[model samples]
Target: MIDFEIPADVAELRDRVRKFVDTEIVPYEKDSRVTAHGPTDELRRELIAKAKAAGLLSVQQRPEGMSHLEQAVIFEAAGWSTLGPVAMNCAAPDEGNMFLLSKVADADQAAEYLDPVVAGTTRSVFAMTEPDGAGSDPSQLSTTAVRDGGTFVINGRKWLITGAVGADTWIIMADVPGEGATLFLCHGDTPGIVIERVMNTMDRNYVEGHCVVRFEDLTLPESSVLGSVGQAFRYAQLRLAPARLTHCMRWLGAASRAQSIAIEHAKTRTSFGKPIGRHQGVGFLLAENEIALQQCRLMIWWACWHLDKGAKARHESSMVKAMVSEELFKVADRCVQVLGGIGISDETPVAAIFTDMRAFRLYDGPTEVHKYAISRQLLRDAAE
Candidate 1:
């Protein structure tokens, strides 16, 4: 039988994260420091300081000891406020970068590039998506890193690079002529790396927003290579599977927050004779939201359980990410509808959550891509 119980320690930590998010982070929702692009580095630093003081800074940094299932619980709590993940330093790009670094970085690289980020002392960017046909398909990667005597010179453009504006570290993906694609870890201010501009995106939960970057003969020593050459695609799967699952976990929390707000609005707002929640239309939506949230939680836990057991969980994670992203978007949309006019306005974060939820459906390999992958796996199993 599958045990549905959360261990006492994990449950306690979850409550702590929930309390911290609600009390410490939510107030910053209206902070002017949160710009149209995204929260600034100064704002991020201030928030990270709060989480550090609260003793919540480094839990996710130590990926080796932490349980993936437990991470789902903590990440969901941190995700309650969009800024909650930011405050706790479990936000994406950095969190995923930590995972990749933990898997591949040697001692020297970890010390200079990864440790400070894990400490929440610095922000990092992952440069994988390109302006051309490479967003969803990494094979379409056109970035080149040519061997120049002792150092490799990289030249390419990467866009939609999250947290690039004021980041301290970077994980760059480029193709070596004969060795295939590889990951290169470099300092943010490394010569030849440029932050072209911040891209205005629908979502604003990220620290520096999405950015366009160009590598103009960015050169790094052979030691800059993460793991062995020609192994990045393999390592990327290692990073993406778990990272994708965590996305679902965090967004699940955001959608839950939106649902709570909608339910409360339904409880107090009057329609014909009584509270609108009494109306079947509004009440049904709340019921649907409850059911969808539970589904999302279960899917997340199931996938995470596999990862905790040392399962690759690639297929499971794809299924979970695809299903949860779509379902949570529906939950957020329904919540907005239930709130009516107030939903469209910034009166509550429901609207913002709705917007982010839509974007989530597209990121982490869009729902269609995941569905395609799932189908391909099933077909392969049948053919075998």
Candidate 2:
């Protein structure tokens, strides 16, 4: 049996987060301090404090617990505003990192890294995408971790690493000689780790900027390795499966908000004979937005249900990621079109949402990559 209903308890939590976002976080969307690189530490702390006071911070880690399905609900609410995830302590890199650490890190490591992040006091990054190397393709990883006695020396350049500028810790992916790929934990300020530049990007809500970083002979003790050596791909799969669905959950929120804004504009704003929404062209767009939003939500929940059941849901996650990323973008696009000029302008968040949603397709995993993985699995099943 399959159930799509939100339990009463989870609905209450979702409502709480929704109210907090509407009351506390949405107003900060226009703060000049909320830069392209995201909110400053002071601003972030201020908002996080408010969220904490409201009992919404780290809602995913509540003692009562949150299943992946429940997380999809609360996270969707948090995604209503671009800052909602950050304010609620459920935003990416950190959200994904916390999940990774809890599953893989030792107690000491968790206290050192995950605790602060879960507490909303620190930030972290997963360093995998690199320039001229492993972007969507993990096999092309060029970063090397050379074992020297008890320590390993890491050397490589990683680019477009989100939250790299102000991160306290990094989960670095590097290739070990004859060991495939491995994960390493290191402080952001580790000697020889350099931030070459913060890439100026389309969206600026990531807190730390998308960065180009160089790990020039950075060293870490053997104890710093996360999980087993040469298991980076497996660990990443574990992280990515849920992370990808969460991305859909959050972006779908953004898309839903955009659609709401467009609906409002259509209802009140005037046109030739009546409200612009009366026009078939505009009405159909809003209709499409609603249909797409519901579909995206269902896809996310379906994948999350599988995950909660202890399935990796590799193919399901891939399909949802590829579909929702592209579908949500369509939803955002329709919202923008329905708004006309204001949609593209910064006067509204639709433009920003549209821009962010565009990048959503490329991150996590590209659409083409997911399709390839899905087809490969199908081929294997057929052969079997």
Candidate 3:
């Protein structure tokens, strides 16, 4: 009932991307210090240039726009290598920011902020998570953007903001009195914008370390507002449906790589004069990993297909995110177990993959949050 076969054109694109990752990105993985967040600016620039040369950058954004299925395939391929997403210019926070900007930014705003991002010349951050609150609930947004003269003065503290250190711009979400929440585009260097410190996370290789930012009367022009005033919440909700699905696609690729490593280790690594893979314990664990990977792939494709039909996949996205993150974490942990000491050490990517997958449960709304949402929706549907 499900077709996993990609179109010929998309298949070609996938192969091309896979080749690029194998040749250009995987080499960097050997360096434990390379960090998962991605390459430095200069290094990123070089990689982006290489991606452009290969016609791989910006593949997520087609000339006529992209179907969800197409974007999923592209991101899955990009996720093959940890650097593949960055190299192809389809990495997160930036990708989600670009998607939001494309939907709402005016021509002037697009030319100023969005163009440079697409060209890979500038980076951006989405500052939404707050120190005290505002993690899972957008309504609890505490940052305030009050209008003053012809400008909007923003004041708030945001933490765990991705890409804050080296970002050139930001799309900040803040509360507007009486009007609800709003989105504003502000320059990272704007007056009163303060970078508290880059919080070291489990995954340290992020291009701009996860940072805590303080906006002390940061001001923006009236024109800097993204979409309608008081519509920020709506925009955010819309953006996350696709954004979460994309994360699933990318993580699935990473999980597949981990599973492959584990399978190979099982086949060759021997104990008691026989390959350990022959043992039911090891073989069944490997089989479970494979089954989980396939199950995630199917769920992701279903969500992507729904998105392509212009359907709001809020519930579906939540389900897939919860499912994939949990499954991937299990698979990564299993890989580490299968490889023994080598898996736990930096000798292989299993350890890092396991660490990274743990955070996936926290970011993008967490598993508990999604479960609550799904349950609420089911109850509402049943009552109706």
Candidate 4:
């Protein structure tokens, strides 16, 4: 049986995270360096230092470890501010990569690659999506890694790779011809690897802007393989389900923040006569936002509970990701509408939250893809 109850330990951690975000991170939201394009490297380091001092810098798990459900609470609090997750060293590409490494990386690999990440000293990118190829579909992956004696030569163009700028490590997915898909770990500064460009995206809260990158005859030793060759999709699955749900958790916090700001505006700003929140039309939006937020949280907990029980949560996560991303976007959009012109203005983070939530629907597998996958699973199960 699934329990949605929050344990005492997890509740304490969530409070701690909320306090830290409110006290430490929110003040920096308006800093010039915390640009529309996200926090600059210098600002990132400063915030990370504070998080490190507070003992919240572990990227993957606490020393005591956390169930996925506990992680959901921590991640949500971290999402209170656009920078909170990064500050706590639990932001994506890195967070998901850390989870993947912990599951698959051998001892030496973990020491060399994962240690710096967990220490908040380095960031990594997942290079899987390609320009004309693997975006939502991995079977169309065009990147290739060909073995030659003891080393493999890789060539591919990858787009929409997060954290490519100044990232020191990478998890590259490529087709290995007869061996099927495979994963390669290589240094960002390795020869023949190039960052083509960082796309100027609508939401700039991503520390490293989404980027286009290329590998031109990049070579790696046999030891660079992340796990068993031909298991790239299997390894990726381990990261995808949990990572998808975590995105929901963090974004739920962001949407809730937007809702709270809107509520305050409605309470203080007078409409025709007195506070606008007195009007049913205006008040219903706030009411709906609350309902949606709670629903998203419940969906996240359900999926996370399955993961904590050592079950693959692929279908459950798909449902949560599609529903939460779309619903959270609604919550954010309603906040923008309720606040009027000021809400769309960058003067407040609500405008940015709306844009960020829109992108959330696209990444981690787009909404349509998840729905299709879920439907297929249901039909297949019924047939069985």
Most TM-score-accurate candidate: 1
- Runs in model 2 deviating more than 4 A are none
Measured on C-alpha atoms, candidate 2 has an lDDT of 0.90
What lDDT tens digits, residue by residue, belong to model 3 across residues 259-289? Answer: 8888898889999888989988888889899
Give each model's clash number: 0, 1, 4, 0
lDDT of 3 at 23: 89
Worst lDDT run of 10 residues, candidate 3, spans 30-39
Name the top lDDT candidate: 1
How well does candidate 3 match the true structure in TM-score terms?
0.97
Model 1 RMSD, rounded to 1 decimal: 1.0
Which has the higher TM-score value, candidate number 1 or candidate number 3? Answer: 1
As a whole number from 0 to 100, the lDDT of residue 370 in candidate 3 is 96
Per-residue lDDT, model 4, residue 335, is 97
Which regions of candidate 1 fall more than 4 Å away from where they truly are? 62-64
Give the clashing residue pairs of candidate 2, or none. 36-204
lDDT of 4: 0.89
lDDT of each: 0.91, 0.90, 0.84, 0.89
lDDT of 1 by residue, 1-384 (tens): 999899998899999999999999999999999888778989999999999999898677654577888999999999999999999999998899998898899999999998999888899988999989677789998999999999999999999999898788889999999999999988988999988888989998899799899999999999999998888889999999999998998999999999999989999999899999999999999999999999999999999989988899989999998999999999999999999999999999999999988989987799989999899999999999
